[model samples]
Target: MTADREITRRHAGLLDRLKRPELDVDETDDEDLRHLELRRVVLEVAELDHAQEIALVRAAVARFGKAGQA
Candidate 1:
């Protein structure tokens, strides 16, 4: 959603008042931001595997190899 529709976690407190708003009325701004940041870190880490062949890429990391330029 755009900035105009953004709702901070604090905004949720308003829901308990007389004018109760729709449950999950709007997307959680904090959760959305955290999700985005997490996605970015996961993607960058995946790209730094440095394996030329998919077969060589194992789930176990042997070493903390040099971090490649993002």
Candidate 2:
């Protein structure tokens, strides 16, 4: 798979995990660490104002090209 597709897949997976009510994952696992880290980031991002969110989206799109399209 292309890198863009791979990244999209991973992002979808992370969001899926975030939506779950509870995580039964093992804390020592590297993948679980990533999930937890994403949770932390989401909590922090939740505090951003509308303009900050727009700017963040713009920057992310500039780098990842709308879901990592090349």
TM-score of each: 0.20, 0.26
Query: In candidate 2, which residue ranges exceed 4 Å CA deviation?
Result: 1-47, 65-70
lDDT of the structure predicted as candidate 2: 0.76
lDDT of 1: 0.56
Off by over 4 Å in 1: 1-32, 48-70
lDDT (Cα atoms) of all candidates against the true structure: 0.56, 0.76
Tens-place lDDT digits, model 2, residues 1-70? 6999999999998898775586676756866567568665785657777888899988976887556653
TM-score of 2: 0.26
Candidate 1 TM-score, true structure as reference: 0.20
- Candidate 1 per-residue lDDT, tens place, 1-70, comes to 5654556544665665656465563458766666678665785656655563453554324433633422
* Residue 46 accuracy (lDDT) in model 2: 79
